[model samples]
Target: MRSPRRQPVAGAATRTGPPVPPAWMRWLPVCYVAVVLILEPLTPVDWPVSFLLVALPLVTAFAHGPLVVAGATALAVVLEGVLAGTPCCAGRSVGYLWDRHYVADYVCTVLVGGLGTILAAHRIHRERTLADVRFVADIAQRVLLRPLPRRIGNLRLESFYLSATAEARIGGDLYEAVPTAFGVRLLIGDVRGKGLLAVETAAAVLGAFREAAHEEPDLAALARRMEQSVSRRAAHIGGSETGERFVTAVFAEIPADGRVVRVVNCGHPPPLLVRPDEVRELDSGRSGPPLNLGMLLTEAHHIDSYPFRPGEQLLLYTDGVTETRDANGVFYPLARRLRSWGPLEPRTLLDRLHHDLLDYSGDRLQDDTAALAACLLDGGPRSVDDSSEP
Candidate 1:
């Protein structure tokens, strides 16, 4: 059996943490130096041997810091001097100290080297500033959507989130897990829009869920509480935009000692039930309208229950996963693709989906994607109130 506390989720794309090549790779410029040296003797007098010297610093800048570039510049200047004294087309060495050709060549080499060094330093400063900004964004993301624990009681948990906007660490997609008095309550959702407004709505929804999940006894009641919270918050929004905001969500509860999972869908995509023998979608007949739009529907939200036996897995995801399209506009067939895997642990399942989604989209997605996978362990669920007793 897999370890309960170990997380196997693939990490999100990180912009601020660009990979640095190995130390040995930095010496690649040494090969270019060799090429330039050999080419100098073979070229004709009009070929401009000093032109190659200026390239040394430029090439070095990519892998080395300003200090290293300065060292390279010095070596380049030395090589230029050597070239001036070497034999040219007429078998006579090119003039040295006083010749205008050598003087101009040396000056150009110095100028190019200095400019390259400055550029390298500026690049380093810009990267450092970006890193600081990303650190702040990471903190904000954690506060807004708290990270899910790898293990909660007897269930193994794994989650993945990818924002459509490049360089944006967080987006409107959200998920949260709360060990409440009733059971381990979970919420996965997607806001109707994107950008700052959507993020604010998402934050409001999560805050409401965290507070109410502990008080509600059933998944339907919990979903209604969340709907009320969103409605109340949206009511405060000014102008015609107030009624336009809404959220698609799926709320679930895994009881403390039962092998069953209760779900209340709110105009959201259905969750998948993957077992060793088969894969199926948990299509709840009692599903209702999305949050903030419940006034249109007269019936109370339906609560659907399904067996969640040991070694089985449940996957909750936003529409981003199902609606992703390729160049030909073909939607990602998640259920069809999932059937091929038979059964897998929560983390491994998410990891495979993450890569597969990227491959399908050619590494670019039209919307943000978020997924949560939970695997039932071979034991009775621990009481949420008294975990120490378990």
Candidate 2:
């Protein structure tokens, strides 16, 4: 079933340009000038305290734009003249304003100010370019990994995705759920490598799953189709990396009856079954080769079925979730976290998991992560006809 597209979490971290400086930072040039003015009258004239104003434009450039830096430069030159001409306790004369030493100070201030203005302009241009690049990346990510529907048939779904790169919106991890005539078919996988190539591989896998989920009745056959798709994509890419490009994925089918869930594991992390009493891993005794490497396996892929009655939640995630490490290098305890929590709605379960994972890893991830949480609601479809209800 199709649902409205929504961000994974309400307050999830977003990729943005460099942070804006604090308000206090913006006033630093003014503060510096005030300090200079206060010290000029009290200090000895030999100190040439007015010459220190040359730094005004440079300081302003850090927090302000080109125009502000130029203004600060002009202000510094005028203030230097004022201080040179005004009689202080040292009894300086107005003739000192045109003194070669004072003139040199003014020239130096203007030179530094010109450089500061150019620096500010370059910084602003780079920020705008970075912003444009991030925008395009975000759009591509949304298109490749469209948000999963909150409700598909009798299942309540919630999903989360995080890229390891702070400025990247998507990476190697991917997940997709489609409600088909047979049931709700879910796919979650991680590409073998990082960067744009991995993203492209993920896109190929997801495109294949979305198209084949409705057509393939058997989980094994669906997996085979994915393998073929990945193989063709690799062939098209055609490089030394082609041999390294493979995906570990899990395919799940939640039947209309909502009595059981069938899962096919392909060299991927097993899904966790979270029940009110206990949590279980739906591990297929025999593991299948990952996509693009299916030819290495002579035996058929293993499909395991486990009871998935109402109130039970199934959590599907890439290895990135479990492999996340703490400051001490300990892997995240995914099952323990699930077992400790009381029954939670699908969205709440995933939201908590997302925050917990980030907190456990010190708010940094070594790999791209993706997760899908599905809770079977009460009075779910009991048959094919019952599944037709909206």
Candidate 3:
């Protein structure tokens, strides 16, 4: 089935069409060599300068692509013959335009440039192959772990995820959402480490939650499954000390009724609950340990719930959002910063947050960060395609 179209998230932008071959392709350095080799002996009218004509096609090929390269070479040959002279062919011997030197120079230009065009085409193919690989990897990542829904049921969802390094894609930060029997369950968390491994832990938590959310009636059981999944996976890698390897997270469910919400905070930042009347931070009340913290064996066993009303929204995220620091080494004022934008679509909220972060750091982010916001409403999602990426 075909997927619905989506709008580009605020900050993400991509260039269209093929990559440039190379600027020098418009004229080969070898064309420069041809001029020196042929110019000195030309019958002033012969103008070995015809050879220089080859450079335009060759350079254009490099600056553009194979088709451009071929046409450029052909145009160069015609221009060289007209401006300079043509070969002294027997058929046109009576004309000065048919001089032997002019013919030889024009012929040589085509031969040299034709070879350059062939080679430039190969280079273009190689570049396209590399680009294809990168594109496939990007598409696969988006599929395996689809982005958090822009709108889950009646709530408007918006998010931002940035890796620790500019080159990175996935990171230790993770979030997930799915419509379940109870409601639209959403989660946001941060692993202890960074990079691919953190993503693995995140996947494990999400996988468990997906299955448990629908099966378990009690919220604590759902939280336990997440804890168990992370713990079990960590043991397979790290062993006994894994308890200290925790994931700070906030989990919540937006019910079908659209009038209420419940949450379980596990050593994560308390989500800020925003309503038309007022904006307030929601505490964990009685908290559970973060998912991977194996404290479950001997520690407590329950998760907390909350009151989520319509026209209200919830913002859940890792410490990266609040912990961002600025020029004087001062931390970013998240609450005050968010106050700058009163209420907005989730995608816009995330876009502005990402922009604020980049601006705060002067065009670069220092640490990995992730944020997810959802607005409660009395209606179903506006439209599926509009809610996600295009």
Q: What is the C-alpha lDDT of each candidate?
A: 0.81, 0.83, 0.67
- lDDT for model 3 comes to 0.67
Error of 3 at 351 (Å): 3.3
Q: Top model by lDDT, which number?
A: 2
Q: Tell me how many residue pairs clash in candidate 1.
A: 0
Per-residue lDDT of 121 in model 2: 89
Q: Which segments of model 2 are wrong by more than 4 Å?
A: 1-19, 89-95, 382-390
Off by over 4 Å in 3: 1-62, 70-119, 147-153, 160-169, 238-246, 257-260, 284-288, 296-298, 327-329, 379-390
Of candidates 2 and 1, the better by lDDT: 2
Please write out the lDDT profile of model 2 over residues 1-390, one tens digit for every residue.
322222342222356775587899988998999998888877876887788999999999988889999999999999998888877536665447888999999999999999999999888888878887867777787788876667776788888887665666778888988888888888999899888888888888988898999899899889888989999999899988776789999999998865899999999999999999889998856779888997788987878889898999999999888999999999999999988887788878887887787788877778777898888889837443233321
Model 1 off-target regions past 4 Å?
1-25, 88-90, 237-239, 385-390
lDDT of each residue in 1-390, candidate 3, tens digit only? 322222222233333345653546445645654563465344453334445665565555556666766776677667665554333422333434456776776777778678778877788887778667656545544643466666655667776676655445566777777777677778888888766677777777767777887887766677777877787888887865666667887778776764667888887888887666566777746677787764554655545556776666788878887777777788888777677678766667777778777768664456678888887766554422234432
lDDT score of residue 29 within candidate 2: 90
Q: What are the root-mean-square deviations of the candidates from the true structure over C-alphas?
A: 4.9, 5.1, 7.9
Q: Count the backbone clashes (under 3 Å) in each candidate.
A: 0, 0, 11
What are the TM-scores, per candidate, against the unseen true structure? 0.87, 0.90, 0.67
**Between which residue pairs do clashes occur in model 2?**
none
